[model samples]
Target: MSDERRLDVLRAIVQDYVSTSEPVGSKALLERHHLGVSAATVRNDMAALEDEGLIAAPHTSAGRIPTDAGYRLFVDKLSQIKPLTRAERSAIETFLSQSVDLDDVVTRTVRLLSSLTGQVAVMQYPSLNAATVRHVELVSLAADRLMLVVILSTGQVEQRILELGSPTHLDDEAAVAQLRSRVNELSVGRRRAEAAVALVAAVAELEAPPGDAQGQSRAAVLRAVAGVLAEQREDRVVLAGTANLARSSNDFPLTLSPVLQALEEHVVLLRLLASMDGESRESVAVRIGAENPISDLASTSVVTASYTAGGVAGLGVLGPTRMNYPSTMAAVRAVARYVTEILNQ
Candidate 1:
């Protein structure tokens, strides 16, 4: 059989099985697709494909289903990712543009992706480590208490409250203002690591005597602000549409328990998201069936794209391997681009 004809047959089988959740047979392929070939020729092509392990017969059924290798070939051979319709583009913009903060953007993105792809959507919070310190505020709550607010360029806010050992100069309004000004001077416009180092050095420069309460309080506030900057370096993920998985329970023949458990364990999802960092932000990465590292996800597929230029964060959808790759890839890519645009703004 000609390789082109055989590939066309494989493509037909994959499309048919994915849509109908049923094995594809030679007769159905001829009826559904225009192959311009005889039934006998089509049968021969199917046999060849089966021999190549690209298609397989499940149980006693005469029909064939594409194997993981076949799906991989189909994905790799795709000429173009299907473009989102005007309505899809408008919906994405309308929904995401209304976001009020970083949390809202991530939350709305998860919902939008889930609604678009009919699969579980996962997104990583943009890496604050890459975000420059936009501003810092110190609010004096009491004679011995203060609130440190660290704002990042990514629109994320980190706040920590400090309780000094005793009443100190922070209790005076002018003293608090001076310290806030100094903190911003040292940390503003720098990345988290640089800001932390600067804040720590500022604290070390304090010449407070061992028994000096005011100097000690100022150093404590600076150290606490540095700690807040350091703490946000860890990555986090948000998930939505887990109910979509249960709705497609038939897709997971065994049970949805394992899949649900894996999703709850954010580490598994984070590792999967991180693994796609090598791909460019403009490219979509698809891991099908057994290609996933987690055994529990062996029956599933993950479609992901980096939403940041540095590829430090990403968003994706998870569904059965029988998913519609073209549309899903398009949605993931579209949403990722929109997210990147928002982050850039």
Candidate 2:
């Protein structure tokens, strides 16, 4: 068989194996596809592929299966990512647009991704380290009670309430409005860490008339809130569709136990997803079989892409090596693109 025909045969084998979860035979290829070749010629090509370690025979008399190397070649050389349908796009937009807060948006996104790919979905929470302060909202509920909310450029919102050492500087709306203006002036447009430091310094220097306990209380509350926001630059990860692993448990040669345990380790997954760095957020990275760092994931494939600009965070999915790469890659790319747009809004 010619080189073109052999590659075509290889592609056909991978497709059939993924769809049916069974070994594919040369006769099956000819019977199912118009390869324009006799059974004997196809068997010869299969032998050549086996010699190259791309395909393997699991039984002495049965058909062939694609090896990890075979899957890699198929993904890199033969496949084009299938584009999302219009209905899929509309569903994503509708589900994400209804989010009322940052937490809600992330929860919905992870769940939506799982449903789309039919595999385990993972997302890294937006990194506060990449965020800049947009504004600081301060409210005095009572004499000693203060509520503080910090808004970030990435549309993430964090809030905290404080009990001051004494009465607040403002019990009236006019005075509270003035404090908000001053806080924004000190913090808005600055990096989150830098803004926190500046806000604390500005509040500390507040001048108070003699014996002004309320001014002291205000300074203390602002300082506490600033410190909290600065320390809140935590990076967390969210995962969904873990139960999907159980559905295809038979795919794993030994058992899915190790893979399940690895998925439960949030830190391990964060590092695994971040392993595909240095590429633009628009591109998808696929790691097959032993290509993954954790050996437990050796039986799996990971497809990843950064969600927002500058790759502030990442999102991806995990499935057996027999996964449908074209469709999975398309789903990941589309989800990441939509997530970026939503956060930007």
Candidate 3:
């Protein structure tokens, strides 16, 4: 069989199987797709595809289904990612634009992706380690207590309260203002690591005289601020649409218990997302069945893309391997782009 004709036959089979969730025979292929070839030619192409391990007969059925390898080839070389419709684009923009905070953005995004693809959606919180310091505020709660609020470029806010051992000069308005100004001067516009280093150096420079409690208190506050920035390096993930998995339970040959167990393990999902980072926002990574590192996910597929939100993070959907590749890829890429835009704005 000619290579183009053979690939056309394989594409037809894959499309048919994805739509009907059943094995595809030559007669169905001819009936559905105008291959412009004889039935004998189609049968020969199916035989060659089966011989090449691209298609297989599950059970004793005469029809054929695409293997994992076949799916990989279809995605990598044959499939054209479908563009999102105008309604989809408008829905994404309107839904994501209404988000009031980082938490809300992630929540709405997960829900949107799940709704778009009818699969479980996962997203990583933007990494604070990669975000620059936008501002810092020091509020005096008492003579020896202050609330430190650290704001990041990604719109995340962290607060820490510090209690000095003894009553200090923090109550003096001018002294408190001076210390807050100096901390911001040294830390603002730098990343977490860079801000921590700058704050530490400032602390070292604030060595006090014998009874200069003002300098001592100032130095202690700087040290505490540095500690807060240094300790926020952990990344978090959010998920939605787990019930969608139950809706497609038949897609999994085994029980759905293992898949649910894997999803419950956030560390596993985090590691998987971290490993699947794409080269850019436009690059959508697809890990088909058996290609996923997690054994529980071996029968599933993950479609992910990286987005920048003051930092790089991942978002994607997980579903059975028999998913519609073009539509899923389009939704994942479009949502990721819109998210990046909203965040950067």
Candidate 4:
């Protein structure tokens, strides 16, 4: 009768469908929920919801399922995410607090989300091009080989190795010292890719040959920056809880396969997270089924929250279309907040 009663019915139907993975019928809704109405009245409400495109019934005798619009309404207006319990809060705090390095922090964060939610979890380390360099070190490994370590403001560490076309006349210790000074002189506090491109072009301009004064210095810098950016181009993308998808046998081929394929593409996931930029890190974003631009992901749903280290970088997570939005959103938002705090510390 009233919009309120219809909304209550919609919520009940969605919760029932999500748990049962089946269409919801009016008789079932009336039998299970204390909706204070007859089955006929409930059926009328379902029809209205269907007309509004919030719920759908697949067969003549079947019950209803919430459409994307329905879930969006639920997440945007009706859903109340239960807060993390004290135990969960303490455990997340403990796990994240243990990490003193960026790699450790992200690894633990992915595991934490997977364990807590039992869903496929994706965490994106910030784009290498967006980060400011904290420091760069050149360590000589051999007469003709050297290792370049690049540290970013987010505590991310990347190392690259460069082999000289021919051994330089300088001693290993002296060459390393000179290389570090030269690379950092140009790269520290700059973008690795941007600086690397510039440094490479700079080296390609030297008037002297490879072993000459201007040429040798420029070549060393070139090798170091190139190594670091090349390493970052093949970045890390950690995924867990894939077995959880196996439990869904109802529409396995149609629903799960595409999502799994999309997950394997690091570039796709990165682009998805990157496209959701401009939203504040604390805000929760909803991408409905089929709204995902990736055709493989069209049947899946994704909710993303950008986790940031103040001004340094941001990380994100992607899960299923039928996700427990309230709980998952809360878990993701809380973890992102705590992780940012840890990185800031």
TM-scores of all predicted structures:
0.91, 0.92, 0.95, 0.80
Give the poorly placed runs of model 1, Cα more than 4 Å off. 128-131, 170-175, 208-217, 232-234, 280-282, 309-311
Cα deviation at 26, candidate 3, in Å, is 1.2
In the range 123-168, model 1's lDDT, one tens digit per residue, is 9987777878888999998877888788888778778787765675
- TM-score winner between candidates 1 and 3: 3
Q: What is the Cα root-mean-square deviation between model 1 and the actual structure?
A: 2.4
lDDT of 3 at 171: 84
Tell me the lDDT of model 4 at 145: 69
Ranking by lDDT: 3, 1, 2, 4
lDDT of 4 by residue, 51-91 (tens): 99999876776588888888877777744668899998999
**Stretches of candidate 4 above 4 Å error?**
27-39, 140-146, 165-182, 197-236, 251-255, 279-282, 309-320
lDDT string for model 2 (206-272, tens) is 7466688657665776687678767855578888999998888978989998999998898888788
Candidate 4 overall Cα lDDT vs. reference? 0.72
Per model, state how many residue pairs clash: 0, 0, 0, 3
C-alpha RMSD of candidate 2: 2.2
| lDDT preference between candidates 1 and 4, better one | 1
Best by TM-score: 3
Q: Tell me how candidate 1 scores on lDDT.
A: 0.87
Say which prediction, candidate 3 or candidate 4, comes out ahead on lDDT.
3
Model 1 residue 141 CA deviation (Å) reads 2.7
